[model samples]
Target: MKELAYLNKFFFKYKWQLLPGVLFVIISNFFAVLPAQIIRIAFDLVNENIALYRLFNGFDKQSLILDIFGSSLLLFGGLVIVIALIRGLFLFFMRQTIILTSRHIEFDLKNEIYNQYQKLSLAFYRRNNTGDLMNRVTEDVSRVRMYVGPAIMYTINTSVLFVLIIIAMLSVNVKLALYCLAPLPLLAITIYYVNSIINHKSEKIQRRLSTLSSFVQETFSGIRVVKSYVRENNIRDGFAKESEAYKSESLDLVKVQAFFFPTMLLMVGLSTIITIYIGGLQVMNGKISSGNIAEFIVYVNQLTFPVTSLGWVTSLVQRAAASQKRINQFLKTKPEIINPNPNPLKVNGAISFQNVSFTYPDTGIKALKNVSFEIKEGELLAIIGRTGSGKSTIANLVMRMYDVDEGEIKIDHTNIKYLNLEDYRSQTGFVPQEVFLFSDTIARNIAFGQDQLDMQKVEKAAKDAAVYKNIIAFDKKFETFIGERGITLSGGQKQRVSIARAIIKSPQILIFDDCLSAVDTKTEEEILNSLGNVMKGKTSILIAHRVSTIKNADKIIVLDNGEIVEHGTHHLLMNKKGVYFELYEKQLLEEQQELS
Candidate 1:
């Protein structure tokens, strides 16, 4: 499979472990074939065969009995005992290596997927669900490990076992060996049909499983909204429907497995019967001795187990194939932004968009069309717009989140595409609209963006964001661990912490994507004031929905339908009798009326 080829390097990495595992299997099979020949020799010796009696004289009946019932059997049983012990020992190590190999692959796959996620543009997340992506990272990767590890081992072992049995059987009686193998072709055909059904059903099961995982994640995340809106029953019913689909699909896979294994056993039984009947006739007709017929029967069953193992191995393969397709898709995704020329741009807080046009990847419609803006050093510009008017797109472009389809964007007069993405991003700080905090101490979260520690700077940033008092109120102070998604804090508190994170970066340019939306207007004003002093001599882009928030900007740009409709100083825009004036007037009236 083209998709499976991606795992070639990983398989080669652990060949040391696999090599010993292969050797142990060979050794086990070698001893396994010896016993059948030994039994034939014993049969010959009992019938007054002088050669076998002379050959086995040292370990006679007394010695064999003592070895079995006393101590002499140990020598006679040496091959069997050593084979079992070596097989068991190697099996234990093999299991350990398998687990380690699976975990190692899992770790690499997760890291690769995560790093790709980081490199991808924001449009990628816009097109994919948060929950669905989580499923790919966790559930899909585990499935690949299961397939590559145990399934691979069993497939190899089974093939080897079958080959060794056939060789042993032919050495005793070629005609009977051929008869024993007659049922195998038919069995192969049946397994082919059964595996096809399993493959089809397994893909369906995996799809339903992803949907089920997504539904549970989405419902739990929105549990508050569901409860407040009295939609618990609706969500519960939806989850139940998804869960039932997953159950039904998994049952379909099991249905194929249920039939496949039993059919395999039936085929094995038929082969054994054929070998015994045909070999029985040869012995009676004096074509072969009874001892040879007995040896043939034992080898026939040895061959049967590998055949049965095919069914189990097939099931694991199908599950893996489905998972591999998803991972391959992730690996093949192309980032929206790439370095056509790898050069580092030295940033000085000035940015320009020259007749830029951009569109979201999954949608044909433009999010920012014919947009041009210039931000000079030490200037604060506010962006105000209605809900879908490309306010966030402008901020994304400044950070090179998505490259413009037409025209160019530059930082400090250098084209952003030529710059190394890591170096370019290092010069900028963006505080997103939705605040996301990790489950760590406040101090650590604030300093998360930087590589080195600076506790004093972190304390100063927290104070500047106006959350120092709140942090100190906790008994643990800056060391307090916020629970998942900052569940321990209020909405406004989370926003402040995120602002503190941006402040700690002290980047050349800062873009706050409506980061002040949650706090009260008074707190908003205080934080903005603090930002102005801290961000002096640096470029800042403030995005907000409130008129009071951006009235003091050196310039304010009004956006509508992915186009810039107005641009001027706040006061100048208010006197233009355009869209900006209407918004300001409407907001003023609403505020004045609220006072009444």
Candidate 2:
């Protein structure tokens, strides 16, 4: 209930709907309870007329009594039907208002969670799995909705019925009514203890469901890997194991319910039995009429559903408390990176790293150390490094993917952190080593960076990235579906398409980190030639391992084990015969050997 308190704002938000729904519950219940009193009156009337008919022996007098008696019974029967119809109508209204409002709340809650997920930093995503996050937004919210709709409705109905039935019973005969209600206090105490056990079991079941969902998501996403490795049997066996665990947890909860519902029914049956025994004894003693006993029985039976649902509502609220706690915890998380400035600023893209150092937070690996360099606007600076030499770390810092742990990164002579994160990222074009494109058409994928798709810009960007020829060769050309993650295309084609998508924005700062690793040297030269023209007025940072790729740059920096080993023009580095010269000579020899 403490966790469920968070939903009070939503209840208040839709108060008008909830208020009417509650009214409908009360009114319908009032009509339903009235029928029991009618039944009592009809029974008493019949009982009275039985003696009156016995007293009138002659035809005329007895016939008169019979006619009146028959007519009165019919009238009472008609009245009960009308009351039932009226109650049914109100029940319809109850569902219309309350159930519909729950759906609306569901929509708002899902959107709220999705928006929060979008606003969270990448570090937050690193900490949580996609399945757990998805389950919280979807399955957990669904459980909570059961509390908001059916649980709440049943609770209100039960409470109203209890009040009406108890008052009516006491007014008729206090002693019998008290005896009938003797079992309820024990029933309630049982529910209280059962509720704690159910709460604990429900949370365990939900966590198991999250684990199951994660396994399925990961399996589907990596199905190709599984098939290629011939691990289909292994995956199937794993799924079976998870499914069995999920089934076991579900059965454990079900077992508790199996124990719980019967107990409630047994208590209900006991109350009914007590009503019959006590009421019969009172009637034998001439304290109350048989009709009173009939009415008491109706009230007890009417209580049957409400009493059963009391347990159900308690169960629902408990599960909902568990789920809402998870949701509230997620909502409370503040993103590590936030937009520092409300106002958008100009981006000339003069990016500089001053005494910069960074460590990957997840792995705690030092990827950069006190490295300093500056790339002016409209200058092309290339970084060459061995694998794990922090070349990509510089690219990541320039793009603001991760804030540096030490020292300052500035753009246009302002600290990068001070810029609006949205504005800064919007002005930059990044092509990471691994390419990811949506399961969309070629032109649409190229134009995915913006809201509006322009085919002309798409074509131009595709031509510049040198993927236009490959796209045209397809049957539908730009309209061809690239498949998931662009798996329909070859590796080099995917890389080029990713480049096209990046350049389609005409960004101020362009960072390409090993984006050309998939293509041959010949295709690389053509793409680089096109990029030279496209990047004429923009700041470009090219990160690569091939010397041929960066030899023509105005400046090149070589990184070795997270430190700068050389920084100079290509000519100066070659003349110095340092690490840069060694790599250049080695690659050149390999190419020459392959050519021969």
Pick the TM-score winner. Answer: 2
Q: How large is the C-alpha RMSD of every model relative to the true structure?
A: 3.7, 1.5
Worst window of 10 by summed lDDT in candidate 2? 119-128
Model 2 lDDT tens row, 372-449: 998889899999989999999898888777889999999999999999888888889999987899999988988989
Residue pairs with backbone overlap in model 2: none
lDDT of 1 by residue, 7-93 (tens): 878878877866776776666666667777765655544554444345667775645543443332344367556666776776666
Model 2 residue runs over 4 Å out of place are none
Task: Show model 1 residue runs off by greater than 4 Å.
Answer: 43-79, 93-102, 340-344
Q: Which residue pairs show collisions in model 1? A: 66-72, 67-72, 67-73
* lDDT computed for candidate 1: 0.82
Best by lDDT: 2
